[model samples]
Target: MTSRALVVLFKELREALRDKRALSLLALFVVMYPAIIGFTLNRIIDKAGSPEREGIQLTVVGSEYAPTLMAQLKQKNVIVTPHAPLDEQATTDLLRTAKTVAVLKIDAKFVENYAAMRPARVELWYDSAIDNGRKIDEVENVLREYTSRIAQARLLAHGVSPVTLVPVTVQKYDTGTSASRSAMIIGAMLGSFFIPAFIFCLSTAVDTTAGERERRSLEVLMAQPVSPAQLVFGKLGAATVLSAVGLTLELVIAHAILKWLPLEEIGLSWRLTTADLTFAILASLPLCLFAAAFEIALAMNAKSFKEAQSTLSFAILVPMLPLILIPMLDLQTATWMYAVPVLSNMTLLRELSKGADIGLLHYTLTAAGSLVVALLCYAFAAVRMKSEKYVLAV
Candidate 1:
């Protein structure tokens, strides 16, 4: 029986390797995805590190009334170069260059309004879309700080205590590990990568099984000396192994790409420790099994490859819905959340990556639950295989 199942596994693997379509899909998942992610991270780092302090210039384009503002900027260690009063076009041109990140456009009647104690507005012309919103934030912080300091000085001159300006200060206390916070965000992104990979596996599983049955090969296999259960297990086992390989490759790629990326600098400490990696690999077993079994069962119900693909695709995507919605909800992973399958793995991935110790009971329960579900699905698939109508319809 073992030899027969081994032979079946070998046959399926060989076929997958020989099939150009299957190989191409696997290559896309393994190679192209990593390349895109690596290049994107590299670009982000380069852009963020480009604006070094030495000789970095912010073009100040305005009339000659804001000498104090220039002095303030100079005192803050930023090199400010005074340019001739700029029109809209000139300001736009300055913003396009690497040297000039921004242009401080002073209103025409700035000094008179300040002397009269009236409201004054400063226009900062710059690109808000640069370097993942960092440049814009930097400019806004500088402007706000400068404005507040000036206002405080003015208030002091009028014998007013600046203490009244600040009504209250709120201090934040975080109970979470700094590493966990960073790992959680990166883990969310990693979860998205699995979605597409799982979709491929689900689609492929159904195509390999039910599609083969509809093509009349299943009867030929059943006519052999192997039991129906053995045949199904062989097919499911092959898919589970392949899915594991795909997942391993994705993790290796993620590790390599993240090596050069400055995740630590950005307060993201998303390194997968040894225990975390082991847990991730072990935890994924139930997920893959359940997904494989469900796809196989759906395929058993399907009359053709097209129908199976459509059915499995929709179901496989159900796991990804939470991944898409997780960012919007802004909720941290709670203990109860570990009961959910995909979300559980996602949360565990985050916790593990951040070096958090996960309880063995939780991991065991989740894995067992997933396995139970997969077994039930397998039973359903077996029942469908027994149905003469199903076999005859295909």
Candidate 2:
């Protein structure tokens, strides 16, 4: 039985390799996904590492009224462009161009208000649609400092202590590191990694089963001395092997790209070593197997390749649910997460990326859960192959 299963396995693998379309699809995913991911991350890092005030252009309407404020803005490296007073429409138009981060509209009564010892109004105009929140915050901070200094000076001139206006001072401390922030972003992307395990093997699984049947070759193969169990094992094993190889290559390429890029530039870190990556690849092997077996079992029942492809395409979403929904729930990692299939692999990779010291038990459960499902699927496929109805349909 073992020898016959090996024979079937070798035959399917050779045929799969010979098919140019299948090989092309596999190669496309192996190279394309990682390259695209690396390019995007590199661009983000470059944009994030640029100096804050490097290209900041701020438009001011009335700068003569507050020479001290203008000096403070220039000292903070802000490029203040003086312009004629603009109406609401003009300010909105300027912000829409995104040429300037924000506009400062000094109230026309600013000098009079200050001389009369009344509250002054300064209107800060910004486009909320733009993603320049950090730059806007910097401008606001400078304005607040200027206001506080003026208020303190007025208090001292009136023979009152400047400290009388202050009640308490608050300081802020952030405990989160760049690594954790990077891990969150990477975790969102990692769920997509396991999807290819199902996709890369889709053509192979459908072709070997439904394609063979549609070509009137399945009956001839079933007449051989091999049992249904051996045939099912051989076909499923071939698909599983192909999926594993494809996923392994993807992981290696992704690891190399991540390690080579300067993730620290954007407050991100990829601390995975070669050994850790190798282990992660190995741990994810069963997920590939489970995907292959599940698809093969479904495809064997279909009457045509297209029918199987359509059905399996939708069925693939079942495993993807946890990957998509779990992160949105914002649920803390628990043991139960390890019991789910694709979600388990995603969680494992996320934890590893965060450099958490998850124990061996989590790894065992992750691999075991997928193995159990794969075996059950294989058993069902074998039983169906042995049935008289399936033989007649073939």
Candidate 3:
């Protein structure tokens, strides 16, 4: 808080700004992550909206033998293409291109078997690796319906009730709303957006602590009138500022992309208003502080910049644990979840996206949880810097 601390703060900021690699990395992540998230969601929308607009691309061999089946497929929105008989290898190659959903191969004995009231075989050929599973499933559904209809007609012709074959009928209904479903999917990604908070501050945190010591100048700075707490606070402020600004810009760009995307087509939503988004970014600043403070605490122990960077590299994975694990574990949102650092931010953002009514308690916990931990880390770094052993080593 002293003028000397302010001087130290401005001085560190200037040095960080001069580091071209750090600035470039900051810019790269600011743009790169949002673009990737948008691209992924856009692809999901396209895939989800495909059936009604594009229909299935099915290649049929020996189509003349089954006119009724071809008509039925057309009615079900299948684009049937007549083709010559293909060997197994040819079918495999065709499926590999992803041009066709599947090849419908009518058995040579189909007509003979049908005329004799026997079961006729029809094979659906497709590559299991292809991403068009929905299209293949559609084709199979139509085949099942066609078979059912033939059996029904045969039963009627023989003076038997068709309803006798179907003892029970099952129907499906989805209870989950689109917003709820999308929250889970988007929640996993929200943590990744904030990871840059730690990354953006790494260079400054390492350079200010371990790097200064390695350059034999940290002792000179400590010789000044500034208290150890003030010195750590100044350096912490510099790193936190850089991290917060980069993370804010990254979130802004991501917000624009997510709002611009048609997430509804994929049963997803990003319904964050400008006010909600502003609050989310503001609430996330303490997380940046936590990241910078955590980095500084670790970097303080390292003997050199390289050592600090390598050590902090492993520390980066720590924040990622909750982000990766919680979603996989399908942990329910508890009040206690709002008190866990990175997970709290994700839960808060997810609720905001879903337009949930967040109380002041959740917001307070989200900000306070990280801020408290940040202060603890700051206290540790300050105490470590003031220790006799560290001074003797320097």
Candidate 4:
């Protein structure tokens, strides 16, 4: 940028600094997002580290009829609380109280059915919407094992081999490492870190271009000796500077929180070093630049602040779609992934956190892609400003 552009940059930045409301919103998001991410991971650690899962508390009716089954559940760390017979509505009501994970009702004729060699039904009632899936699964496993053992014993008494019921057994294996598994959980949220790159710059970008035009000050500003390039660069620079700083601070705070967290409790890891984090912050500057330039390109064209804000609000979602949808698609990470804007930054950070041995090529592609897009947007805005029709209209 020329010296003229530098003056314009400082002028806009000074004006922005005086806007306390915009600054406050920026500050709030900078701290708020990292704190939220930290709190979520901490909760996960607490849940995973708890032993016995608080004994998978179970409410059982007719417990006396299946003492052996109760013993089996207890052995598997299920705390059995005996209760009177509950009808369907009562059982549903009890489950809704969240006092226990599930209600197990042993059939009243269990003893009679067992003696007659007939099937005995055991009801396991649980609320599927509740967040006790693991406990429910444990209860079901124990019941299955208990039933299988009884069947095996009955077969032995009839002089039939227990193996006769089995045709073949298949063994399964999981190839996913701890890093990949951890990524599966954290990757869902990784996009949020880069999203601020777009958001923090929105106010400054929109206010400077469209706002000035709405106030009817733009024509006078355009009448100045400064070239159109200088004006465009200056405004774009101010927004980019704020966005870059905000994004960098957010990344550092998030990194500290993730590093402090006991993610290992849930088989997760934050494998990023301070040096790696620094590299990521530096590499992500282009995303901030891209965000500012993209908004400025659109906001410069709009006639008023509200028009700019409304149009940019919808237009911005076009770029962010990749950030929200790519993880859901679960596509394998490839070379081309580094060529996208928001996605590239997130992918780079996620890969780094997984301790992936990143090369310069990845960082180059990540930064270079954003830089190219940013330059294109910048060029377009400059061209728009320099247009003969635009000056005449103003």
What tens-digit string does per-residue lDDT give for candidate 4 at 1-394?
4988998999999989999987987898898889998999898777665436577889999999999999999999999999999999999999999999999998999999989999998899999988888788889999999999999999999999999999898899988777777776887778788887888888899888888777767678788889999999999999999999899889989988888888877888877789999999988999999999999999878766788999888866856687667856868889998999988888898888777889999999999999999999999999988875554534
Error of 3 at 207 (Å): 0.7
Which one is best on TM-score? 3
What local distance difference test score does each model get?
A: 0.72, 0.86, 0.89, 0.87
Query: Candidate 1 on 204-228: residue-level lDDT in tens?
Result: 5875687777788877877789876
Cα-lDDT of candidate 2: 0.86
Query: What's the candidate order when arranged by decreasing lDDT?
Result: 3, 4, 2, 1
Better of 2 and 3 by TM-score: 3
In angstroms, the error of model 4 at 238 is 1.0
**What's the residue-level lDDT of 372 in candidate 2?**
96
RMSD of 3: 2.2
Model 4 TM? 0.89
Candidate 1 vs 4: which has more lDDT: 4
Q: What is the TM-score of each candidate against the true structure?
A: 0.83, 0.91, 0.92, 0.89
Cα lDDT, model 4, residue 112: 96
Per-residue lDDT tens digits for candidate 2, residues 83-158, read 8999999999999999898999888899999999898888899998898877788899999999999899999999
Model 2, runs deviating above 4 Å: 50-53, 156-168
